[model samples]
Target chain A: MLNAIFSGDTPRSRPLTAILLVILVCLALGPFLFDGTRAFSTLGMICVFIVVVASYDLMLGYTHIVSFAHTMFFGIGAYGMAIATDAMGNNFTAILVGLAGAIALSVVLSLLLGLLSLRVKAIFFALVTLAVAFAFLSLATQLYNITGGEDGLRVRVPRELGPAFRPFDGELRGFSIVTFLSGLFTEPGNLGEVLRESVFKVRFSGRELMYYVAFVVSLLVFLFLLRMVNSPFGRVLQAIRENEFRAQALGYRTVFYRTAAVIVSAVLATLAGVMFALINRYVNPENTLDFQLMVFILLMCVIGGMGTLYGSVVGVALFLLAQNYLQDLLRLFAAQVPEGGVMAELVAPDRWLLWFGVLFVLSVYFFPTGIVGQLRIWSQRRKPAA
Target chain B: MSALEKTLDNKSARRERPWKALGKGPRARFAAFREEKPHLFLLALMMLVPLFMINPTTWAVLTISGLAMGAMVFLMASGMTLTFGLMNVLNLAHGAFISLGAFAGATVLTVWLNGYSGDSSLLVNLVAILPALGFALAVAGLVGLLFERLVIKPVYGDHLKQILVTVGGSIILLELIQVIWGPNEIPVPRPDALRGAFIVSDAIPLIGGIALEKYRLIAVLLGLAVYGLMTWVIDRTRVGVLIRAGVEDREMVEVHGYRIRLLFLGVFVAGSALAGLGGAMWAMYREIITAHMGDELMISVIVVIILGGLGSIKGCFYGAILVGLINLYVGFLEPRLAAVATVGLMVGVLMWRPQGLIPVIKV
Candidate 1:
C-alpha cells in the first residue's frame, strides 16, 4: 500500500521522510493552523512552487535539460486562466476551459521547443530558451488588450473559490495546535485552555478551500511525477541523460522521449501556474513570469536534492520558510547595528534575494548533492553499510 | 580555387592565361575573402534593406545608431566569445559586470566629474568622461576576477555547475549592486558635447538630411578600433598567438612551454574589462543606469553571440550589428513585435548555420 501510494519510490531517509510528513501535515492544516495573511500567501506560493520546482527537476535533474523558459509556460498558464475567466465568467467551466487551453498550448509549444532545442547542445538550449522567454514576455506585454499589459489581470476565480463564499453558516471550531505551540513554553499548563474556549475558529471558506485545492493537486502531481520517474519511460530518460548517443544506439527514439519529458514537465508547470492564478487571484508578468522565479525554482531543485521527487517538498518548505521568516531574522539582527551604512543595506529585507542567491552559489559549491542527497548518504552509511 | 577551376574549365579561360585574373588579384582576392567569411556577404545583403524599406536619411541615421548599438554589444559579446573560446566558461554573470560598470560610471560622471559634464567643450567632455569609463572598467574587471575565484574556480570543467554558479553569481552581484547603489534607476548624465544629434542638413549632398549622434559616431569608432586591435593581437602578438594556439590545441601549446592558465586569466580579465567598457558606453547611450539594465541586455547579447557563433570575435561584431539593426528597423516599422522578431531571426540563423556566422568550434 505504501509502495502504491509512493509509486514504488519512497523517501529513503528517516529525517527526509519526517520532514516531508511534517510539511504535508502543516500544509494540510495550514488555514486552521496559521492566522496571518502573509503566512497564508507564503503557504499558497510554496504549494504552487513545489509542483513548479518538481516539474523543473524532471527536466533539469532527470533529463539534464536546462531551460530558462520554464517561466514562459508558467506565464502562459496564468494568462490562460486570467483570459478565459475574463471572457467566460468566473465559473468551474471557465477554469476548465483555461486549463485545457493552457495545456494544449503547452503541448504544442513544448513540442516545438523540444524538437528545436534537442538539435542543439545543452549550452545552446539554455541560451535559446532565455531568448524565447524574453520574446514571450514581450508578446504578453505588447498584447495588452488581451493580457492587460504590464498591469496584468486580476483572475476572477470561480464563485466557489472566492474568499467570501463560506460553505458553513459561521466559523467551525477546531483544536488550535498553533496557539498551543506558541504559548506552550511560556505557560506549560495551558494546553487545555488553548484547545478549549473555542480559541480558534476555522472557516470552511473559499480561501481556505483554495489552499486545500492547491495542496491536494500538488500532492497528486508529485505522486504522478514519482510514478513517471520510476516507470520504464523514466529509465530511458535517465539513460539518455547519461549518454544520448548510447541511448540512440540502443534504438530508442531519444528525441521522442526528450520531447515527451519536456511536454510532461511543461504540463505540470502549467498546472502549477493555474494553481498560482487560482490562489493569488491575480496574475502578472512580474509575479508569474519573472526570470528571478526561475532562479528560485533552480535553487529549490538544487537544495532539495536533484533526481529525488521528495526533495521538492524539503526544498519548498525550507526556502519558503527562509524567504518568509528571514526578513524578521534580519530585522532583529539589524536592530543591534548602527544606522545608514553598507551593513544595514546588505541586511535589508529587499536584499533577501541576494542572500538566497549567495546560498545558491555556496550550495552548488559545498552541497551539490543537497539536503535530501546528504540525508540519503548518511542514512545508507548507518544502515548496516547498505 | 573553385572559381579558378570553373574559369579553367571554360574555353575562354583556356585561350587566355588562367593566372591573368589571379595575377590581377583583386577579383580573386574578393572571391577568397567571400570564401573565408561567407557571412560578410550576409551582412552586406542586410545592409541593403534600407534601399527599398525606408527613406535614405532615416535609414542612414538608423544604420549609424544601429551600428553604434552593435558596437556596444560587440564590446560585451567579444569578451564572452573570447572567454568561451579560450576557457570554455560561459560566464552568465558577465551581465553583472556590465551592471557594475554602469553604476560605477554613472556615479563618477554625475558626482566627481559634475563640473565638466555640463561643459560645452568637446575635449573637456571627453577628458572628464574618460576617467569615469576607466573607473567603471577597473571596478568591473576587479569584480570579474573575484567572481572567477569565488563562483567559478571550483567548477572548472563542469558545464552545468559553471552555468548554475555563474547565474548564481549574476543574481548575487546584481543584488549586491543594489545593496550599494540602492534598488533604483539612476539617470546617466551626458556631457554637453555628447548630448543631442548632429544634424547633417540636405546641403551636404548624398549623405545629407541625416541626424547622427556624436556619441554614436564615437561608439562606432571605438568598436571598430577594438575589433581591429583584437584581430591584430590575435593574429600578430605572441600572447594572442598563444591564446589562439591554445584554443586550437591546448596540450600542444602547453607542450611548447607557455602557461595557458595565466593567459586564460589574462583573457578573462581583459574580457571583463571590455564588458565593463561596453556597459559604461551603454549607460551613456541610454542616458540611464539601473541594476537590471545588464540583465535586460543579456537576452539580446546571447542572441547576438549565438547568431555570430559562440567564441568567434568577427562573428560577434556582425551578429551584434545585424541584431541591433533588425531590432531598430523592425521596431521602427512595427512597434511591439521587435523582441519576437529578434528571437525569430535567431532561430532562422541557427537553422541556416547551426554553429553561427563564424564557426568557432563545435558547441
Candidate 2:
C-alpha cells in the first residue's frame, strides 16, 4: 500500500531518494564512524529532529497551515513517555503505552485546533494556536506534581537500552574495532593504555543503542510521511494549499483534508518527541514545548525548502549540524584571541545566537525557497540551457 | 490646492466645531454604549466575585491593581493594533521596542536616582521621571524607524514572512540589549511620592480600609488620558480622517497626492513611542526590568489585541482590562491555574465572537 502511494514519485524523486538513502546509511553506521558519546548523541538528536521538522513541513509546506502548536504536541509526547516511565517500569510495554496515549492526546488536541482553524482566518489561527501552546507550556510548568515543574522529569531506560557497553577500554584486546581505532592514534605500548585511560576513556556506551533506536524510528517516520505526501491524499492537501477556495469549489472538502493533515503531522511530531525522550532520557517544557522550538522547526523547514519532504530532511540535518559545530568553531576561534581583549566577545558561544539570528533573517529574505528549492531551480535552469 | 493644504484646511474647518463636525459622534457613542453594556455587565459580574470570594477591601485592592495592570497593557497593545491596521504588518519585533524603552528609562533612572537626595517631593521626582520617559520614548521611536526600514520594509504583505523575519529581528535586538545592559534584571523603583497607597477608608465611608496604590491611580489616569488622546486624534481630527481613509483604501489616499507611506511611518514611530512609554511605566510597576520583559509581556499584548478585535484600539483596551481582571481573579482563586484562565477566557471569547468583542468593520 505504501509502495502504491509512492510509486508515482519515483521518476521525479531520484535525487531525493539518493540523498535520503545516503543519510540512512550514514545514520545506521554513525556510531562506528564517530565512535564517541558526543557523536552518537548528536546523530540521535539530528535523526529525531529530522522527523520532527519533516512532520512540521506536512502542515506548513504541503497543507499551507501555520500552526504553532506542533511543539506542544512534541512536548506532550515526551512528557507522556516520561510520566509513564515514572508510573510503570522502563519496559517496552510502558513505552508503547506512553506513545499510544501521546498520539491519542495529540489527535484530540489537533482536532480541536482544527475546529478553531475552521472558525478563524489564517493570522488569527496562528494566534489561537500560539495562545493554546503557551497555555500548555504554562500548565506544564505549573503542574509540578505531574510535570516536575521547571526542573523537568527524568527517566531510567531499561537495562538493555541503558548505557552498559563501553566502546573504548584499558584492555589491550586487539580483536575489537574500537581497540584497533584507538591503537592508530596512540603510541605502540603503554601510551595507548594511558590515552585510553585519559582522553580515549570516552565511551559510546548506550548512546549507540539509543542512536539505532532513534535511527530506526526516524526512518519509519520519514518513510511514512514520504508515502503520505506522495499519495492522492497529499495531492488534495497541496491543492487546498495552492487555492483553498477553488479546491472547496471543486468538491474537495478542505476542512476535512486540512484537519486530516494536521492530525497526521501532529502524530508524526509526537513520534519524534518520544524518540527524543529516549535519547535524552528526560522531558522538560523548555526542551519540548517551547515557542522557540516551534520557530526552530519553522526555520528548518524554510531553510530546507518547505513543500518538500527531502528539503525538510536536508534542513534538519544542516541546522543541527550547524548548531552543534558552530559553537565549537566559535570556541576554537575564541581561544586564539588574547585574554581580556574586546574581540574575544565576538567569538563567544553565547554570541552564536546573534549571528544565527542574522543568518536566519537573511536566509528567509534571500533564499526563501531554501537550499533544496534553490538546488532544484539551478538544476532546472541547467537542463533548459543544455 | 495640494492634498496637504486641503488636509490643513479641513483640519481648521473641523477645529471650529469639533464635537459637531463628526456627525456620527452621537450614533457612534450609542453603538459604543450598546456594545459596552455587555462589558459593563461583565465588570459588574467580576465585582460580585469579590463579595462572594474575598473581603471587600482586598477585592477593592485587587480590582484597582488589575485595572492598573490593564491600563499598562493597553498602552503597550495600542501601538501594535495601529501598526497592524494601517501597515498590514504583523510586527513580532514590537516587543523589542518595548524592551528598548524600558532599558532607556532604566538607564536614565539609574543615573538620576544615584544623585537624588532622597527627598519626598513629587516635583523633584517628576523632574527625574520626565527626562527618563522622554529618553525612553525618543530612543524607542528612533529604533522603531530603523526597524521598519531594515527589518519590516522588505516583507510588507506576507504574514508568514513577516512573522519569521520580525521574530528573527526581535531575537537579534534582544541579544543586542543583553550585550549592552547585561543579562541581569535591572531594578526600577517607583518615585518616592508614588510609592505608597492611599487609604480609601479615610476618604470614603463605605469603601473604608480599601487601599489603592498612588501609582495605580496615576496609571489609570494616564491610560485614560492616552485613550482620550488616541480617540481625538483618530476620530476628531483631519489627520484622523486621512488615516481612516488610508486604511480603507491606501491607493485612493495615495492618488490624492499624499505620501501615505510617510504617514504610516509616523504612525509606526508613534506606536513604538507608545510601546516605550508603556514599557517605562511597566518597569516602574514591576519594580524591575529584564531584557525579556517586553517579549514576556508581548504574549499578553497579543492576547489583548486578539480579544479586542484586531486593529481596534478601543477593543484592545477592553481586552486588556478583561485579561487583567481574569488574571487577578484566577491568581487569587487558583494560583496554579492562573495562566490557564486568561487563555481560557480568550478561547471562550473567540468561540462566542470569532471576530473578537468589537470587530472593527474595515471600511
Candidate 3:
C-alpha cells in the first residue's frame, strides 16, 4: 500500500510530509517545550486518541460501517495488559504477550460481531453493536476476580520505567537522568561517587519512557493504517461501501471484505488501548470501555473530517488543545469578573462544556465537511481556477 | 366442455372444505394469533422462567417488582418511540428532558414540603403531588418546544446531523442542569402517605407472604393510566388517524391541505412532556435525582425500543416489561449477568425476529 502511494515520491505531497515532520519534531521535544511531564502526558494522550480515532476511521470513514463496539476492543487491550502484568510479571515480555493476546481477542470478537451484525441493515448494525458493547462493559465490571471490578487495576511498570529515582538522599533525592545529564558536565564530583550515582540515576521515569514509546508506536500504527487504506484490498472495502450489491455482483464477497475491515480496525484500536495502559499505568472500565469515550471518538472523527486519516491528527490536536487550555482561558476571564457576579458564572470552568457544546453544534452546522474535508475541496477548486 | 367440468369440480371441492376459507388447521390459527398479539408469545415464554426458578413466592415478588420497574421504563421509552416514528428524528438529547422533568418535580416538592410532611392522608398528599407533576409536565413540555424550534427544526431529514446536533444539545442541557441544580445528586423525598409497603400474609394462598411497596403500586397504576391515554389518542381519535397518515406519506397529506409540520412539532412536545412525567416517577422511585440520570437511563430506553421493534408502542411496552423482568431475574440467578441481561434479551429477540419482537406496520 505504501509503495502504491508514497512510492511515487510525488512532489505534491511534500507539504504533507513537511507537516508530519514538524509534528514529529514538536512531539519529540514535548518535554522541553512544555516545561514538565504534564504537557508531555497530554501529548501522549493525544497520540493515543489519534491512533484510536484513525482506526475508527477505517470502519466509519473508509468501510462506511458505524460501530459502537470500538471501545470494547480498546478495553480488551487494556485488560489484557492488566491481567498479564499481574500474572506474568511486569516485564517487556509480559507487554509483548499482552499485545498478542489483545490482538487475537479483538480480531475474534470483531469477526463474530461483524458477521452477525453485517447480516442486518446498516442502522440496525449500529444499534446491535451498541447492545453488544454495553454487555461487554457490564461483564468487565461484574467479573471482579478477573477484571478487578470498577476500581480498576494499577499496572506495575518495570522499575526502570517507573517514577524517577535518585541514589543520594539529600538534594539528589528524586533526581532523574534528564536532570542529572544536564548538570553532569557543569559540576565536578569525586570520580567514584559520580560513577556510582551515574549508574543509579541513568533511568527514565515511567511517564517519560511511556511518552516516547507511545509517540513512536502511534506513528507506526498510523503509517501502517495509511498503507492499508491505500492498498487494493482497501479499495475493495471502499467499493463495498460505495455499492455493496455491485461489488457482490462483481464476485467480491462483500461480507468477508467488510468483516476483514472490522477486524483490522478493531486490532488497531486494541493496540492504541495497550499504549494507553502503558502510559497511564492503570486500566479501568470507565476510561477504556465507557460509552462516552466512544462518543468522543465519533466527535473527533466528525470534526476532523470522516474519510481523511490525517484529519484524526488535526481533530485530536484541536480537541485536546481546547479541552486542556480553554479552562485556563476561562479562568483568565473569570479573574477579570467581580466575585459572585453574572459574568463570573459565564466564565466558570463548569460551564466550559456548555461553550464546547455550542461550538460543536455550530461547527457541524457550518462545516459539515470538517476541517480536512473543507481543505481538500478548497485545494481541488483552486487547481481548476489556477 | 373439459374446462367447464374442471371448474365445476373445483367449486364442488371448495364447497366440501369450507373451513379452508378461514384458514387451515392449528398452524393457521396460531399464525393469526401471533400477528394480532405478537408479544403474547414472548410474554408467555418469559412467564415460564419463574416455573424453572421453582420458588413461586419469589417469582410473584419478582414479577411485581418487574412490573413496577417496567412501568417506569415504558413512560420514558414511549415518548422516544413516538418522536422517532413520526419524525424519523433521532433526538439523543431526549434524556435531557427527562432529567429536567425530574429536577422540576424535585423543586416543586421541596418548595412545598409542608404539604407533603407529617401523616397526611393520601388525598391531601395527592394535592401536593399533583402540582409537582403538573409543573414538571408544563416546564418540560415548554422546554421541548424551545428545543424543537432551535435545535431540531433546522436538521429534520439528515440522521447524521441530527445525531450530532442532538448530542450537543444534550450536553448543553446537562451542564445547564448542573448550573441550576448545583452539580450534585439531590435526594427526592417520598410523600408521607406513600413510604411503607403493603404486607399481606395470605394475599394469595399459594404465596404465603407478599410485600408490595405502596409507591410502586401507585407507579404501576400511573403508568397504566398514561399508557391508556396514549393508546386512546393514537387509536380512537381523528388526530390519531391523521398522525398515522402523516407518518405513511407526508407529501400526500400535505397535498390534502394538512399542516404536517405543526403536527410533528406537537408530537415532539408531547413526547418530551411524557419523558418529563416518566423522569419524575423514576426520581421518586429511586428517591434521588442527578443531572445525568436521564442520560444513563437512555441506554435502557434505547434497548427497550430496539427489542420492542422501532416505532412500535406495544413493542416498547412489552419490551420494557421484558427488560425489567430479565434484569431482576438475572440479577437474582447470576449477579454477573444482571447488567447485560437486557441486552442479551434484545439479541435473543432479534435472532428470532430480526425486525424486533413486534414489528410495527407503519401504514
Candidate 4:
C-alpha cells in the first residue's frame, strides 16, 4: 500500500527510493557498526530531535503559520507521560493514556487558538502564539502542585526494562540462539563487552529506552507526514499557504485545512514531547515551555529551511551539533589566549549565546534559505558548472 | 502652491482647533462630546477601575508607570506605524534602538557622577538632565539612521527578509550590549529631585488613601506633555501634514517631488529617540538596567501595538493604557499570572476585534 501510494513520477520516486535505501542501511548497521554507548546515544538524540524539527516544519514551513507555542505541545506530551507513568502508577496504560490526553489537550488548545489566530496573518499570528506559549509557561509554573513547577517531575524505569541483561545472560542467550544472532558477534572481547554494556545500559535505563521508542515513533510520524504532504489535502494546504484568498475562492475551506494542519502538527510535536520525557526520565515546565525553547525551535526551522521535512531534520542536526561543538571550539580558542586576556571573555561558554546571536543575525541577513537550502543551491551550482 | 503644501496647511489648521475650541459652551460641547464619548469613557473607566480595586500605592504606581510607558509606546509606535503604513517594513530592531538609548542615558549618568564624593544637589541633578536626554536622543537617532541606511533599506518591502534581518539585528544588538556592559544589571538611580512620594491625602474621607510617588507623577506629566506635543505636531503642523500625506500615499508624495526617503529617516529617528527617552525613564522606574530589559519591555510594547491597532498613533496611546491597566491588574491579582493574563487579554481582544480596538486605515 505504501509503495502503491508513492510509486508514481520517476523524478520523485528516485529521491524517495534513495532516501529509503539510506534509512534501511542506517537502521541495519546502527547496532552492529557502532561501538561505545555514546555513539548509540548520540544517534538516538539526533533521531528524537529530527522528530521535533519535522513537526515544527509541518506547521511553520508548509502551512506558513508561525505558531510560537510549538514547544508547549511538547511540554504537554512530556508532562502527560510523566504524570501518567509515575504519579498514576499505570505503566501498562501510561503511554497510551498519556498520548491520548496530550493529543486531546493539544487539539482543544489549538482549536481555541485557531479561532483567535486564523483571521490574522504573519506577525500578528506570531505574536498571538508567543503570548499563548508564555501563558502556558505561566500556568505550568503557577500550577506547581501538578507540574512540579521549576523543579520538574522524574520517573523510575520499570524493572523489566532495567539494565540487568548481559549477552551471556540466560534470557538474552536463549533469545540470540532462537534468532540465530550468535554469529553477529565473536567471543566476548573489549568490543563485544562494549556492545554488551551498551545494550545493558540502554535496556536498564528508561531514558535510553525512551530514545529508541521516540526514534521509532518519529520515523512513523515522518512517514505519515510524508504521505500527508503528498496527498490532495497537503496540496490544498500548500495552496492556502501560497495564496489563502485564492484557495478560499476556489471553494477550499482554508481555515478548516489550516486548523487540521495545526492539530496534526500538534500531535506530532506531542509524540516528540512524550519521547523527550521518556528519554530524560523527567519533565520540567521551564525546560519544555519557555521563550528560549520557542526561539531555538524557530531558529531550527528558519535555519534549516521551512516547508521541507528533510530541511527540518538537517536543521536540528546542524543546530544541536553547532551548539554542542561551539562551546568546545570557543574553549579551544580561549585557551590559546594569554591568561586574563580580554579574548578569554569572548571564548567563555557563557558567551556562546552572543556568538549564536551573531550567527543567527548573519545567517538571516545572508542565508535566509538556511543550511540545507544553501547546500542544495551549492550542489545545483556545482552541477551546472560541471 | 504645491498639492503637498496645500494639504499640509489644511492639516495644521485642523490640529490647532482642539485646544483653541475648548471654550465652547457646555450644551455644544456635550453634543460634540457625545460623538467621541464612548472611547473617552472607556479610557476613564480603564484608568479608574484599577484604583478602586487595588491597593492605593499599587494603583498610583501602576497608573503613573502605565501612563509613562504608554507615552513611550506612543512615541516609538508612531514612527513604527508610519514606517509600516508607508513602506510596509516591520523593523524588529526598533527595540534595539530603545536599548541603545538606555545605555546612552546610563553612560551620560555615569559620566556626570564621575568624581562626586557626596550626593549631588537637586539643581545640579536638574542641570544634568538636559545633557543626558540630549545624549540619548542623539545616539539613538544616529543608530536609527545607520540601521535604515545599512540594514533596512535593502529589504524595504520583503517582510520575511525584513523579519529575518531585524530579528538578527536585535540579537546582535543584545549581544553587543552584553559584551559592552557585561552580564551584571546596572543601577539607574533616579535623580535626587525626583525622589520620594507626594502625600495627596493626609486623611481623606471617602477614598481609603492615595499617596503618589513624586517621580512617577512627574513621569506621567512628562508623558502627557510629550503626548500632547506629538499630537499637535502630527495633526496640526506643516511637517505633520507631509507625514500624513506620505503615510497615505508614499508613491504619490514621491511623484509630487517630496523627498519621501528623508521623511522616512526623519520619522524613524524621531521614533527611535522617543524610544530612547522611554528607555531612560524606564531605567529610573525599574531602578536597574540589564541587557535583557529591552526584550522584556519590547514584549509589553508589542502587545500594546497589537492591541491598539498597528499604524495608528491614537490607537497606540489607547492600547498602551489598556495594556498597562491589564498588566497592573493582573500583577495585583497574581504576580505569576501576569504573563498569562496579558496574553489572554491580547488573544481575546484580537479574537473579538481582529483588526484591533482602533483599526488603522490601510494605505
Candidate 5:
C-alpha cells in the first residue's frame, strides 16, 4: 500500500524513509498536532512548497535545466486568482476560472520560453529566464491598480473554504493516540485526563478545512510527479540529462523533451501558487515573486536531493524548520553575547540567511549529492557485493 | 579559352565600371559593410528612430543620456562575458562585487573626502573622486579573489553548483555589506566641477539647445578608454593571445608549459575590477547607493548580455548601446512601449539570431 502510494519510487534508504514518514504524519495531522496560527501557517506553507519544490526538481534534477522563472509562473497563478476573485466576488466559480486561466497562461508562456531558449546552453537559459522573471516582477509591481503594488492582493477564498465559516456548531477536542496508549498502560492518575489536555486543540472550522485542502491537493500532486518521474517518459528525461548527445544519437528529440519538461514543471509550479494563494489568502511581488524565494527553493532541492521526488519533501520540511525556528534560536544566542558586539551582530535573528548561506555552500562543497543521495550511497556501500 | 567567353567576361566587367567607381567611395564601403554584417545593419535600423518627430533638444539629451547609460552597462557586461569566455564561470555573485564597489566608492566620496567634492576647482574635485574609484577597484577585486577561492573554485565546470554556491556567496557578501554599511541607502554627491551640463549647440538652426551633461560625457570617455584598453590587450598583448588560446583549448595551453590556472585567476580578478569600476560610476550616476543596487542592475546586465551574445565582448557592447538607446527612445516615444522595450528588443533579437546579435567567431 505504501509503495503504491509513493508510486513505486520509495525513499530507498531506511533513514530517508523514516524522515519521510515523520514529515507525512506531521503534515497530515497538522491541525490536530500543532498550536497557534503561526504553526498552522508554517504547516500550510510546507505543504504548498512541497509541490513547488518538487516541480522545480522535475526540471533541475531530472532534466538538468536551471531555470529562474519558476516564481513568475507562481505569481501568475496567484495574481490570476486575486484579480478574478477581487472583481467577481470570492466564489468557487471565480477560483476555478482563475486556476484555468493561470494554467493556460503558464502553458503559453512556458512553451514560448522553452521553445526559444531550451535549445541554448544551460547558462544562457538560466540568464534569459532570470531577465524574464525580473521583467515580470516589475510588471506586477507597476500594475498597482490590479496587483495592489507593494501592498499585495488580498485573496479571499469561497465561503466554504474561508475561516469565518465552520462545518460544525461546536469545537472538537484534539486527541493523541500515542499519549493515550502510553497512559493506559502506565496506570495514569486519570484515565481520560491525558486525552483532555493533548497539547493541541482541533476545531471543525473552515480554517482546518483549508489546511486539509492544501494538504490533500499537495499530496495528490506530489504523487503525480513521482508517478510521472518513474514512468518511461521520465526514464527518457533522465537519459537525456545524463547525456543529451547520446540520447539524441539514440533518436530522442532532445529539445522537444526539454520543452515538455519545462511546460509540465511550470504548470505544476502554477498549481502550487494556486495552493499558496488559497492557504495564505495573499499574493504580492514580495511573497510570490521574489528572487530570494527562487534561491531558497534551489537550496531546499539541493539539500534534500535532486532527481528524487521525495527529496523535495525532506528538503521543504528541513529548510522551513530552520527558517521558522533558527531565528528564535539565534535570538536566544544573541542574548548570551554582549550588546553591540560583532558576535551579537552576527548572531542577530535577522541574519539567519547568512548562516543558511554558509550551510548551502558547505553542503555544495561536501555532499553535492544532498542528504538523501548521501544516505543512499552509505547504504549501498554497506551492502555486500554479488 | 573560347573567344566568345572572353568577350562575354569583358562585356560584363565593362557593364559594372560606373558602379565599381561608386563602390570606391565611403558610401559604397558602408553598403558593403551593411551587406557583410547584417546585425550592424539591424542595429543601425534600430538607431534611426526619427529625430524630426521630437524636438531636437530632447533628442540630443536623450541620445547623450542613452550613450552614457550604455557605457556603464558595457563595463559590467564585458567583464561578465570575458570571464565566461575564459573559464566558463558565470558567477551569480558578480553583483556582490558591484554592490561592494558601490559601497566602497560611496564611503570614500561621502565620508573620507568630506567637503572637497563640493569644490569648484576640478583638481580638488579629482582629489576626492580618483581615490574613490581606485579604492572601489582595489577592494572589490580583492574580495572577488577571496570569493573565487571560497565559492567558485570548488564548483568549477558545474553550472548548477556554481549558481547555488555563488548565490550563497552573494548572500554572505550582501549581509556583510549591510553589517558594515548599515542597511541604509548612502548618498554619493558628485564633485562640483562635474555637476551640470554644457550647452554645445544653442545657436544651431531648428535645434534650440544641445545641453550635454559634464558627467555623462566623462562616462562616455571612460567607456571608450576601457573598450580601447580591452581591444589593445586582446589584440596586441601576449596575455590576450594566451587567453584566446585557453578559451579554445585549455589542455593545449597547459601543454605548452604555461600555467593556464594563473591566467584564469588574472582574468577573474580583472573582470571583478571592471565591475567595481562600473559600480563606482553607477553610484555617482544615481547619486544614491543601496545594498540591492547591484541586484537591480544585474537584471539589465542580463538583458544586455543576452542580446549581446554570450561570451562575445563586441556583441555585448552593441547589445548594451542598443538597449540603452531603446530605453530612452521608447520611454520618450510611448510610455507603454517603454515598459516592454528592453524585453521586446531581446525577443526580436532572439527571433532573428538566437545565438545573439554577434555570434562569437573563433579568434
Candidate 6:
C-alpha cells in the first residue's frame, strides 16, 4: 500500500521512500539503542516539538500567513487542559473537552481575525497578528487569579491504571508494562529488575511519562496531517498561497479556506499544548503565551522550510537538540577556559543570547530553505546527473 | 481615470485652503468642535462630575496624564506615520532609536550634571539640553542612515524580508544596548525647573474638590509646543513640499531632477531624531529607563500608527489622542487591564475600518 502511494513516476519518490525506510528502521530500534528512561523521555520531547513545528508550517508555508500568534493557540490548548484537569478535576473527560474547547476557540479566533484583516496583505497581516498575540499575553498575565500570573498553575498527575511508574528505581514492573505496551520487550529477572530500579531511581517523573504520551499523540496527529496535506483541500490551500487573488478569481471562497487552514493549524498547536501541559504538569500564562515562545516556534518553521511537513520535523529536531544540548556543550568548552579569562566572558550565560541572535540572523539570511529543503534540493540536483 | 483626476483636483483645493475648514459633514464638524475648541466647558463639567468621589487623585491623574500622553503620542506618531507613508517601511526598530535618545540624555545628566544642584541656572540647563539633543540627533541620524543603506534599502517593496531583517536588527540593537549599558533600569531626573506642579488653587470646589498635578500641566504645554513646531515645519517649509511630493510619487520627484535618495536619507534621519527626542522627554517624564522600554512603548506606538492609518500625520494625532483616552478610561476601570484596553481599541477600530481611522491615499 505504501509503495503504491509512491508509485508516481516522479524522480523524487524513490529517494523519499528510502529516507522513510531509514526513519522507520531507526524508530524501531531507537528505544533499545538509546536505552535509559532519560533517552526515551528526550525522544518524546522531540516528537512533541515536531508536531508543533509541523502545524506551524502548515499555516505559514502552506497558507502564506506569517502568523506571530501561533503560540497563543498552543497556550489556549494547554491552559484549557490545565484548567480542566487541575481545577475541574476530570482527567479523561477533560482531555476531550479541552481539545474540543481549544479547537472551537481557535476557529472563532481565526474567523474573527480573518474577517478583520484578511484583506490586508503580507506584513500588515503579520503586524496585526503580532498585536493580537501581545494583547493575549497581557490579558493572560493580568488575569492572575485564573492564570496564576507569572508563576503559572501547577497540575497534579492523573491516576494511572497501575501504581504510578517510577524512574531510576525498582519500578521495573511498571517500566516493563510501559515498554510492553509500546511494543518493546526486555529480558526478565535481574537485568530487568536492575534496569527498572535504575529508571525509577533516576526520577521517572510525571514529565517522562507525559513525554511518551505526547509522542504517541504527536505521531497520530502527524500522520493525520500528512494524509490531509495529500488531499484536495490541501491542494486548494496551496493554490491560495501561490496566488491568492487568482484563487479568488477562480470562484473559490479564499477567506473561508484561509480561515479554515488557520483553525486547523490552531487545533494542532493546541494538541501540542495539551501534551505540554501533561508533561510539565504545570501551565502558566508566560510559558505558552509569551512572544519569545512564539518567536521560537516561528524560527522553527522558518528554519525548517515553512511549507513542508518533513521540513518542520527536521527543523524541530535541529532546534530542540540545539536548545537542550548546546548549552551543556558550551559549558563543557567553557570549563576548559583559564579562570577569570576573556574566554570565560565569551561563554558566559548572559552572552548566550548574543550567540542566538547571530545564529538567527545567519539562519534567516543563509539557510532560508533549512535542512530538509536543502537536502531535497541537493538530491534533486544530484539526480539529473545520475 | 476620472477618480484619479478628481483626487488630484481635491489635492489642489486642499492646498488652497489648508487651514480654512476642519472637515465636511455635521458629524465631522461636531467632532472637530469637541476636539479643537472645547473651551474648558467639558473640563468644568468633568471637575463637577468627580466631586465627592473618593480617590479623586486617580481621576485627576488619569485625565491629565492621558491628555499629556496623548499629546506626546501625537508628536511621535506624526513622524512615524510620515516615514511609513513615504518610505513604505514598517520601521520595526523605531523604538530602539527612541531608547537611544533617552539613554543619551540620561547619561549626560549622570556624567555632566552629577554635582550641579541649581534651580534653572542657564549653564546647567545648557549642559542638560545641548548634550542630550545633540547626541541623540547625531547618533540616531547616523544609525538611521546606516539602517537605510545597509538594511532597509535591499528590502524595499519586500515586506517579509523587511520584517525579518528589521526584527533581527531589533534583537541585535537590544543586545548591543545590553552590552553597553547593564540590564538595570536607569533613572532620568527631572530638571528643577519642571519639578513642581502648577498650583491651580489652594482650595477649589470643582469635580468634588480635586487637585491636578502641576508637572502634568507643564507636560501638556510642552507637548503642544512640540506639536505646533512639527506642524509648522511639515506644512510651511520648502522641505515639507518636497516631502509631500516624494510621498505622492518618488519617481516623479526624481524625474524632476531632485535627488530622491537624499530626501529619503534626510527623512529617515529626521524620523529617528524625533523618536529620540520623544524618548528623552518621556524618560524624564516617567523617571525611569530600561532596556525593555522600547518593546513596551513600541506596542502602543504601532497601535497608534495602525489606528491612525499609516503615513497620515493628521491621522496619527487623532489616533493617539483617541487611544490615550481609551487607555485612561480603561486604566480607571482596572489598572491591570490597561494593555488589553489599548488592544481592544485597536481590534475594534480594525473591525470598523481595517484601513484605520484615516486612510492614506495610495498612488
Best by DockQ: 1
Any runs in candidate 6 off by more than 4 Å, and if so which?
A3-44, A119-122, A161-163, A166-207, A329-347, B1-60, B74-79, B116-126, B187-193, B202-222
Expressed as tens digits, the lDDT of each residue in A286-385 for candidate 5 is: 9999988988898899999889888888899999989999999999999999999777789889889889888888988898788888988887778859
| Residue-level error in angstroms, candidate 2, position B201 | 2.9
Q: Report the Cα lDDT for candidate 5.
A: 0.84
Candidate 3 chain B lowest-lDDT run of ten: B111-120
B-chain TM-score for every candidate: 0.88, 0.86, 0.89, 0.83, 0.87, 0.80
User: Taking the true A–B contacts (Cα pairs closer than 8 Å), what share appears in each candidate?
Assistant: 0.81, 0.66, 0.63, 0.54, 0.60, 0.42
Instruction: Evaluate every candidate with DockQ and list the scores.
Output: 0.70, 0.47, 0.47, 0.42, 0.47, 0.39
Task: Give candidate 2 regions above 4 Å deviation.
Answer: A1-22, A165-207, A335-346, B1-38, B117-119
List candidate 4 segments past 4 Å from native.
Answer: A1-44, A155-204, A338-344, A378-386, B1-38, B48-62, B72-79, B110-120, B127-130, B203-209
Who is ahead in TM-score, 3 or 4? 3
Task: Report the C-alpha lDDT of model 4 over B1-363, residue by residue, as the tens digit.
Answer: 999999999889767445435567885576455434433654676777777778666676677666665665555555666577556777777777778778788877766653221255766776666577778888888888887887888887777667767776777677777766677888877776677767657476533366567776776777777778877998999888888787677798899898988888888878878878877777767778887677666666777777767666777777777666677676777787887777776776676567776666551
TM-score attained by chain A of model 2 = 0.85
Which candidate has the highest TM-score of all? 1
Which candidate ranks first by lDDT, i.e. highest? 1
